[model samples]
Structure formats: structure tokens, C-alpha cells
Target chain A: MSVTRAWAWLIALTATSTAVAAIGLSGRWLALVVLALAWAKAELILNRYLHLAQAPNIARGFALGLALFMLALTSLAVAIP
Target chain B: MTTPQASVLDDLPGDLMMWVLILSELAVFGAGLMGFLAVRLTDPPGFAEAQAHLHSTGAGINTLVLVTSGWLAALALEAARAGRRARLRALLAGAALLGGVFLFLKAQEYADLWAAGLTFESHAFYTFHMLLTGFHAAHVLAGILLLGLVGWLATPRAVEAGAAFWHMVDLVWVLLFPVVYLI
Candidate 1:
């Protein structure tokens, strides 16, 4: 994606995540949705901003690592009250 | 054997060592975040209460500021590669200024919380908050300096490496904000 386009999506996702919390949503679903958005934003930065797209394997590795981290965090968040 | 295909490493942008550094930094932050989550699991209600005192709105604004700065830094790299020194400098300066804006907003948030009597000892949540976000804030400060140095050098490689580091900073905040403030 173009840098500008990636940025627009980043802004949109950031707004969505922030508004989700601002609306006082809580619990498991909130953790799932918000962290999912965080995952997407991280992917965009890794691929477009960092230009990891040029190296597909490296990009996949970074994505996988981040995905695992996000999953663990989400699991912990959901496991909370 | 047929001629070896170009190494995947060859396609990776910037210095290989920079990517190594980025990966290491990501691992450290990821571990820190995981620890925060594990601790939050212990007393969810207490954690939520502490989290409520945070300024999510300011952090949200900082996320926007940071991503915009990363975009500018990316463009700076392109300008450097295209040999447009002036545009390169302009974009780098813009990115660094936005980084400054992020730091200013973060400082204001910290000050507000401090005045409200939320210190590291207030709760385990605040302790994690101060450490994780404080370390990330230090990175933003370093990134601004890196941008300035690379812009002065005006070398494509230098800018590429610098932009890579700046994006690492941006990416960390993207992950950190929700976990720390929102979630």
C-alpha cells in the first residue's frame, strides 16, 4: 500500500480503538476487538512503514511474532474479570 | 546448480543490523507488555480502576501524531533516495517535530496523573504504566535525535536506517497504547 493510504487506515483504526474504549465497553469482546485492531496497525507499520513487504519471508516472520504476542495479551485480558 | 536466486536478505530495506536492533527492541517491549497483562490478570478490578484514571484521549491523539510522523519519515527516505536533499530535510524535520508534539502531550498526561497522586507506588498497574510507557517515551526522544542526525547527513542509507528506527518507535506505541490505556 502507498504510505498515505496506510496512514489513513492507521488513523481510522486508532480512532475506532479509542472510541471503543471511550464508549465504556469492557470485558472479553472489548479485549478481542481492540487488540485485533492493534494487530492490524502493527502489520501496517511492519509492512508499509518499515518496508518489510520487500522481503516476504521477513514480513511473515514479524507478522507471526506480533500475532502471537497479541493473542497472548488478548487471552490474558479475557481471562481477567 | 542453477544460479542462486537473490537472497531474501538482499530485499530487506536498510541495514541488516537495523532490523536486528528492531527485532530486539520489539521482543523487549513484547515481554514487558506480556508481564503487564499477566499482572493485570491477578486483580482485574483493581487494574481497571487504575486504568480509568489514565488519559486515553491524550494517548489516542498521540497515536495519530506518531503514525503521521512515521509517514513523513518514510517519505523522507524516498526523498533521500531520489536525491532531493531539501525535501528530505523538510520531511525529516516534520517527522521530528511531530515526535516532539507526542512527547509534549505525554508529559502533560504524566504531569496530570502525578498531580492527582498516581505514582508508581499507587498500584501495580501504575508501576507497569510508568515503566512501559516511560521506556517507550525515551525511545521517541532518541528517534527525534536520530531523525535530526540523519537529515543532516542527507545520505539515503542513513535516512533509511533512521526511518526504520522511527517506525519501530511508532509500531511500539501502536501496540502499547491499547494495552496500557484502553484495554
Candidate 2:
């Protein structure tokens, strides 16, 4: 997909997920859904929009660390209740 | 004027170290959200009552401000890519102004909430409200500082990094609005 198209799709997905998560879900489910949408948006920004594919190894490593951190936090939250 | 041949990522300037710095700031906000959630689950009534006091319209307006700033910052990035320094500056300034407006509205909301007896110790939700909004307000303040610096520097890389930070700020609000207002 083109960059513009991909961005639009990502935005739509985020908006829908946010609205649903906001109005309908709660607790672990809400956190999980929001986290999933956040992950998707972050990936779209890093991979598709920013084209981190060409980024330096160090930057890529940092991005990977960020992803892991987000995953860990979200997992802990979900596991709590 | 000759355009620079640098890739967007390559030209990203200033303390590239600031990216991680900004990420650390985000981690602080994330911690606040996690704490707020934990407290909410533990004391649902206090949280629910505290949430009821929040002005959803105000929260919605703040969310719009951050999102608009993000959009402007994105446009500024594109302008920087095209090497239009004037347009870039204008957009950066616009975003900064929006950030200012957001802060102003947030301060007003806090003042009103305080007047209405919604102190940090008032209830569980109030604690969550104050903590979450306090952390977010700090981010907004940081964003305003970054936007000001971007306006001053006007370098392509700085603009890109500024856009990244602004987008992150916007993203956090996207989560916060729901957690604080709707949910």
C-alpha cells in the first residue's frame, strides 16, 4: 500500500479501536485492546512511515527495546486481574 | 536555494540522544497510567465518582488540541522534507501555540476541579485524576519546550524529531482520554 493509504488505514484502525475500547471495554480487556492498537500504530510509524528499515543498527536496536518494554508493561497489566 | 540530499532520518539533528530522553518521559507517564489503573480496580467507587466530576467536554477539547498539534507537526515534517523553511517554521509555531492553549485549558480545568472540592486526597478517582493529568501536563509542558526549540533551530532533523515527539504526545492522549474520561 502507498504511504498515504497505509496511514489512513492505521488512523482508522486506531480510531475504531480507541472508540470501542473507550465505550465498551474495561479492565484487562480495555488495556489489552488499547495496547494492541498502540502497538499497531507504533509499528506503522516505525516501519511504514519512518522507514526504519534503513535506520542504523543502533536505532533499530533501540526500537526493538521500546517494543519489548511496551509488551512487558502491557502483559503485566493484563496479568494483574 | 539548493536542497540538502540528506535522508530524513540521517538529517535528524540536535541531541539525537533526546529521542531516548523523550521515551523516558513517556515511561514516567506510562507508570502513572498503570498506577491509576491499579488504584481504580482496587477502589472502583472512589474512581467512578472522581471520574464523574471530570468535564468530558474539556477532556475532549484537550485531546483535540494535541491531535491537531500532531497533524501540524506532521505537515511541518513534510514541509521540512521539501526544504520549505518558512512553512516548517509556521507549522511548528502553530503546533506550539496549540500546545499552549491545551495547557491553559488544563489549568482552568484543574482550578475548577479544585474549587469543586476535588483535591488530590478527595477520593481515589481524584487521586488518579490528579496523578494522571499531572503526568500528562508535564508532557505537554515538555512538548511546548521542544516546539519552541524546534521553532528556533529550524533544522530539518530537528523538525523530524520534533514531529516524532509531538506524535508521541498525541498518542498518549489518545490513550488517556479514554482511560480518564470515557472509561
Candidate 3:
């Protein structure tokens, strides 16, 4: 698919997740939905729109760093409670 | 013969700079989210009570504004990539204006809250509320300024980068609203 089409899909996904999140459904279901959407959106933005897939080694490292940070935080949310 | 090569090289640094700025901004917002979670977990009842003082309707309106602004920023990025200068400028301006409206509404909310005896030191919940919203408000202000700077720079690539940063700001708020208000 084209970059624009991909981004549009990502945005739609995020919008759907945002709507669900706004409903204040705090539980395992809400956490699962958020994790799914967040992973999809982050991957699409990084690989497709940002073109990080073609990035140099150092840039790729930064991308990995970002992913790790996000993962750590999301894990914290799940692990804490 | 040399012009195109020079331009391509110039583009790389600018694009990289934009990414750096965006990543840094996200880090700040991430920290704020962490703080919110920590406080909420530590004092659930207090946070719930404090949330009562917030106007859900107002937060709902602000969410709409930020989401619309995110859409505009996406449009701006597309226009910039296509080298549509006029469209980029107009969209960026519109997004900045929406950010301004957000800040104005937020200020009014704060004033009203204070008048009703809700201050930062009022309680643990109120303290977190003020800190979270206050930090987000500062980000909105920064975003408005960044958009203005992007307009002044008038570089197509820079405009695209600015749009990316602005969209990230809006996305953070999307997560923040439920955490602060509904949750």
C-alpha cells in the first residue's frame, strides 16, 4: 500500500482506540486495546511514514531505544497493578 | 549540476533535527504520564475526588479540538511534502489557532477552579490535577510557538517536521484526557 493509505489506516485505528479509551473502561480489556493500538501506530509511523526502515545504523538504534522506552512504560502499567 | 545534490544533503540534517525535537518532546510527555499513573495509583480516592472538580464537558470539547488539530497537522505534512506552500501555511495557522483556543479554555477552567477554592495545595488530588494540566498547557503553548516558527521559516521540509511534532502533542492529550478525567 501507499504511504498515505497506510497512514490513513493508522489514524483510523488510533481514532477507534481513542474513542474506546475515552469511555473510561479501566480493566484488562482497556489495557489490551491500548497496547494493540499503540503498537500498530508506533510501527506504522516509524517504518512507513518516518521511513526508519531505511535509516542508518545509528538512527535505527534510536528507533529501538524509543521502542524500548515505550515497552518499559507499558509493562510498568501492567505490572504495577 | 551541484544544486540538487546540495539540496538533498540539506534536507537530511533538517529532517533529522525535526525527529530529534519530536523524540525529546515525546520523552517529556511520557514522563508526565508516568507521574500521573504513579500518583493515581498511590491515591486513587483522592484523585477521583479531585477529578470531580474538572468539567467533563470542557475536557470533551478540548479533546475534539486537539484531535481536529492533529488531522490538520497531518494535512499540513502532506501539503509540505507535495510542496504546496500556501496550503501548508494555512493549515499550520489553523492548527496553531486551535492550540490557542485550547489554552484559553484551559485558563478559564483554571480561573473558575480557583474561584471555587480549588488550588494546587488544596489536596493531593488537586495537586496532581494542576500539575498534569499545567504541564500539558505548557506544551500547548510551546506547540503554538513552534508552529509560528515553522511558518516563519517557511521551509517545506521544516513544515512537515513541525506537523509531526504537533501531531505528537495532540496524541499525548488523547491519552491524557481519559487518564486525568474519566479514569
The most accurate candidate by TM-score is 1
Candidate 1 residues lying further than 4 Å off, grouped into runs, are: B1-6
TM-score of 2: 0.73
Candidate 2 residue lDDT tens string, A40-65: 65555554444454465645664686
Best prediction by lDDT: 1
lDDT (Cα, tens digit) per residue for candidate 2, span B137-166: 887888889888886788778887777777
Task: Tell me how each candidate scores on DockQ against the true complex.
Answer: 0.86, 0.19, 0.23
Top of the candidates by DockQ: 1
Better of 1 and 3 by TM-score: 1
- Which model, 2 or 3, shows the larger DockQ? 3
Off by over 4 Å in 3: A1-24, A27-81, B1-14
Q: Tell me how far the alpha carbon of residue B162 in candidate 1 is from the true structure, in angstroms, after superposition.
A: 0.5
lDDT at B103, model 1? 96
Question: For every candidate, what share of the true interface contacts is present?
Answer: 0.89, 0.01, 0.04
Q: How well does each candidate superpose onto the true structure, as a TM-score?
A: 0.96, 0.73, 0.71
Residue range B1-183, candidate 1, lDDT tens digits = 799888878888789999999989999999999999999988888998999888899999999999999999999998999999999999999999999999999999899989998999999999999999999999999999999999999999999999999999999999999999987
Q: Give the backbone clash total of model 2.
A: 1
lDDT of prediction 1: 0.93
Clashing pairs in 3: none
